[model samples]
Target: MTGTATLCTVTAPLTLFAAELGMDEGRIGLLSGIMPFFQALGILSLPVVLRFGSRSVATTALTMRYVFLGLFLIVPFFAARPDAVFGVLMAAMLGFAVCRSLAEAAISPWSQEFMPRSVRGRITGRMALAYVPVALGVSWAIQAWLDGRTGLDRFVPVFAVGIVIGIAGALMLLGLRGGRAADSNAPRRRSLTEPLRDRNFVIYLFASALQSIVFVSISLFLILFFRDRLGMSSGALVLLVALIPVGAAAGNVTAGWFVDRYGTRAIRTALQAGQIGLLLALPLLEPDVPAAGALVPLAFFLFGFLFQAGIAVGTVYMLNVIPPASKEEYTALHYSMDGLAGGLATFAAGFLLAWIGAGEVSVLGVDLGKYEVLFLVAAGLTVISALAYSRLHEEGALSVRDFVGHFTTGNPMKALWGINRYASRTSEDRRRDLAFQFGGVGSLLAKEELIAALRDPSFDVRHEAIRALGHISAHPAVLNALETVLEYDGLVELRYAALGSLGRLKATSCAPRIAQFMEDPNPLLRARAARSLGEIGDLSSLPRIRTMLHDDPDLDCRLAATSALGKLKDRASMPGLVDLYLEQASDRTNRVAEPRSKVVLLAITKIFRCEEEFSHQWRREEVQSGLAMPQILLQLAGRVRTGAPGASAKLRELTSDYNAEDTAATLAALAELLPALHQSRHRDSDLAVDVLNEVRTAAEPHPALLVAMAAILNRIFAA
Candidate 1:
């Protein structure tokens, strides 16, 4: 019952909200029709909500829906001034659309979280049935109430009723529940940046967003075709509009059931083909033929039904591809892409409608509406989307042996042959199970698999091999295999992974060769090379590394330098590290008003702490007098002040052996450094006191050192 009310509130206003605003029936049709454009924008935020947990986000979205719907109702009260009221109403509509989009985003994942996979489709389909009846009822009620009345007065009551219904719907949804818990024995939090690197997920999102644009175009404009082009009366138009929900409901149920029985690929392909057929025939139907008008409702129902089913299947498809831990980020990336595409599509549809004139055009012996061209174009997009969808192989469907041979050897043709041969003989699920077995067979076999994968023709197989190599890091042969591809692979991602693998292997022999890649034209390649260099920690390459710090265009490279320098722990690089820190501090001060720049400053501070620790280690080493220990200690003291949490413990440990005589001489010379190191910024005060106590103990052994230690300690304690 709750789900039914929610669907009613969601789809009903979309049916006639534009009409209430006094838009030319055609423009109103397009206006109300394209609300999904703005709705897509809200959808992009889904990942964020999902990451935080759906329950909280859903409640928040529902509350916002109430606010927006209330504002929508109030717009009619101020309708004496049409333009202002319409503008306000449109704003309200946008707000409501965003809330509903949020609701859709949350519900899909929430449904997945709670429902069993086998029954998920059926349950979602059943829930969707609520929308059909609500849409029909709302359309009938609005058309009936407006039959004899004219002007804004009669419409005000309709909007008022909508507002009340919206509120009730929101309240009901707020009481519904299910969400992922933060403490569920899930894997450790993934790096927030990782999911963006997923190629399949990225492609899937692009296809999904494109699909949303197609649906939005059809939904927003279909009603106008019935009323204006078909010349359907208000009552007939209401019935026609109502059929969309019926069709959508049926599609949802059937698609869900089919998906449970047949899998995503089959359902998606069938529905997309069905949609193409419906779209192609839509333009041929004539308004004068009463039967032709009836076909419009059938067409609407088919498009609506199939579109929803495709979306449901696609959602399942996405969940299957992405790791469960990364679902939120994947969802976010998906919705963000959807929002962007939907917005662009809506804007494009407006221009298209105006350009093509939305009426009949004679082309290649066939009469078609400009709207039909839009549908044809949409059909073309569906084809493209389906093609992209076909590329997603089920997880673990390829053996490690097959993956490696195809990807590493750069022969994808052979890989595709193998996959097709395998597919012909085995079920996809069984093939996937075999693939997992291959993954578990240890690194040597995995290495062999990767080598074989390199010879395969499919990019998907090749890419999968690269990922598996990262996991099966026990093989030194894997490094050589990756390096072989690095010089020849067409994909930059493959090249980057190869470089990263070399670093992961700690292959010092590859250091010089890897350093050469730092000069690559691609910034990402250069950054990868720099990071790999840090991992190898070969000081012989420090000169080249230093050159990159200054010459590389990427900040990631510079950050990698700090990391590399920390690994090398070479005292000679201390000056360079200090200069980098000072440069960052200066940049921060110059851009003090920018929060993002301040974050850069924070990153720089972290690097400086690394430098400080390196210097501390150097001070503990036995070095000749020529090396200026006083100057080094003075610089090191300055670091302990602004360094991160554990600096005090480190400072005390390193300074414990300081000579009382050297301390006395340094205290006077390093008086300025003393107060900075002892500043309250060091959270571990006991460590600070210990440093002072060591200085006091040193004072007992040498009187002059005692004076110097006292002077230094006094300055530090006072500060």
Candidate 2:
């Protein structure tokens, strides 16, 4: 249909052939209206189509359109009689139009019944992809053949090729699924006015009517304008006009996805706004100007882009708006009325041109010619159409106000791209990507997609969805969704992700609820809760976190508590931080160096405003090896907090001795010593150091921890 439609319908070959038959722009415009006017009568054939079966009816009609097209080959035989040629051309084209419309009317219901809804968009998109290039290739060949031709003979070859291609496309339709014959007893039919009873659909029809008129007439007339005003050859005209389909093809790439994300109304309204601008520009492409002619290709490209994109989005809108029971009737009426409008407008435009005459009229110093006036009026109607369509209700559609933001800030298009890719993916990795895409965008559309993603059975996808909800904190539902996961979700990872996201959102309302998770047996959940409290700035949870810092059985929980204290920046937690340092530094049970040692030290250093001085000192090997050193420094911090200045000479001696100790050997020193210090600390450090060296040389292998216990008891005695 695409390849044949270009040459055999209201396109370059047909219009040029009509012009060659001595038809003016007025008569050519009337000729362009022929197909659509006949299309308005297509609903009359619906009962027959439905009874015989849609595929069969569509296939038969499609084959017959070519039979009518074959008459164009006979048109050149009557070149001697102008009267015979015009009558023959009109009659053949009228038959061609009726058959084409019958094919369209039947194909819709045939597809609706045959194709599964899930794959319809994909199948049609693939069809468009497969046919557009073939159409372009065929049109290009015709352009090359018709480049320097004259008379009706030039169209004969083009028509012959169109007939062959059109018949082949028709025959291929027989292989499609479903389209079985309806029952012998037909069901009672509803009134055609059923769709008209829908107030919103009626509103939609009004906007669609105006849009159809402008879109249909503009493309048909641009060819005539090029020929009459620019002296462009038929071949050059066809080549330049072919960009419309190319642009339309490009537009379909994103149009359906946008309709899915942003909804049909918003996408359609925006496309109409673009069409209005394109229409206004058409009037400016005046004759005898190089710049005007240079812009012709671009103008047609935009025309095709907006035209096809609008139709693509409009199809989705109609499907969503119309009920299934009356799908065929609603569809038929929409096409008939929209085509009727376009047909009438095209015929009227020709009469308008004939009425306006060739001479220019000036108003406010701007010259207005017939084509310019026609285009400008079309632009004006389109503006009104854009405004009207903006108000039509489509459930889940983006409002014009926020849809405008898609141009400035949103990922509606990017989300659509991800969704399109996501639909075909089998792997969790591929499917999980769409969940992550919603994180940075504030679009509620993205938020909705992310919410749906949460229900995805794949843990990775749901986990990412929970994480993404954290980034979009504007909506109350975002907080609610995150909290729901934190409270009831059985997946520990998803709950953990939810907790982290809640903190990222700074959801203080969820903070108290989060604090309860501090006691969760899952160490990751406990750590995450403490971390979220810090992130949420839940100062009331500071006491509990400090307790976690001192008493959490898990090393990771303790490190998390230490990091949380750093984030909270609470001066009152200094004693707990000091105790944490003292505990890690002196424990002997923990054999390997862990992040706990460095994390606690960093927290104490942060409270002291010395993190910059200590930042480079927290590497794993370096921090654990210097545990005794930080242990001494935390002792100094305690004295400083108690209003005592450290003695510089003693500090230097301790630092030098600590640097001389074997780092790997002393990694367990704090592990041995600090556990015993929970009981008490020795004031006499000299005696303890001597006992530690003696125990190191003992042949009986006395544990350093037992010796440290003895030192703690001695401190208790001293006390």
- Each candidate: what lDDT? 0.59, 0.70
Tens digit of per-residue lDDT, candidate 2, span 58-149: 89998898788777788778877877877787888788889888888877655566545444444445555666676577667778888766
- What candidate 2 gets wrong by more than 4 Å, as runs, is 74-85, 180-187, 260-262, 286-295, 361-365, 395-490, 505-523, 533-719
* Residue 645 error, candidate 2, Å: 22
**Weakest 10 consecutive residues of candidate 2 by summed lDDT:** 698-707
Q: Report how far off residue 79 is in candidate 2 (Å).
A: 5.2
Best model per lDDT: 2
Give residue 207's lDDT in candidate 2 (0 to 100): 84
Off by over 4 Å in 1: 1-52, 77-82, 180-192, 358-368, 395-719
Per-residue CA lDDT of model 1 for 1-719, tens digit only, reads 33333333434444454555655544443445334555554445644564666777776776676577666556666767767766775676677767766765665556556777667667768867866767777667766776657754565566566666666666665566666445545555534476667776777776787787787667666666666666665545655666766887898887776565445765676687787787777767775666884577678788778887788778777765666666665665575566557656766775677666746767788886677878788889988887776665654233223434334442344433443444355554544443333444333333555656655566555555655565555454667777776886468887887787678767787788888887788878877887778778777778877776666667667657656655555444544554454454335355532332222223232333332433333344325431334444544544444542244344444455555335444443333334445554533333334334433322212222222233333333334
- Deviation in Å, model 2, residue 296 alpha carbon: 3.3
- TM-score of model 1 vs. true structure: 0.50
Per-residue error at 530 for model 1, in Å? 68
TM-scores vs. true structure, each candidate = 0.50, 0.70
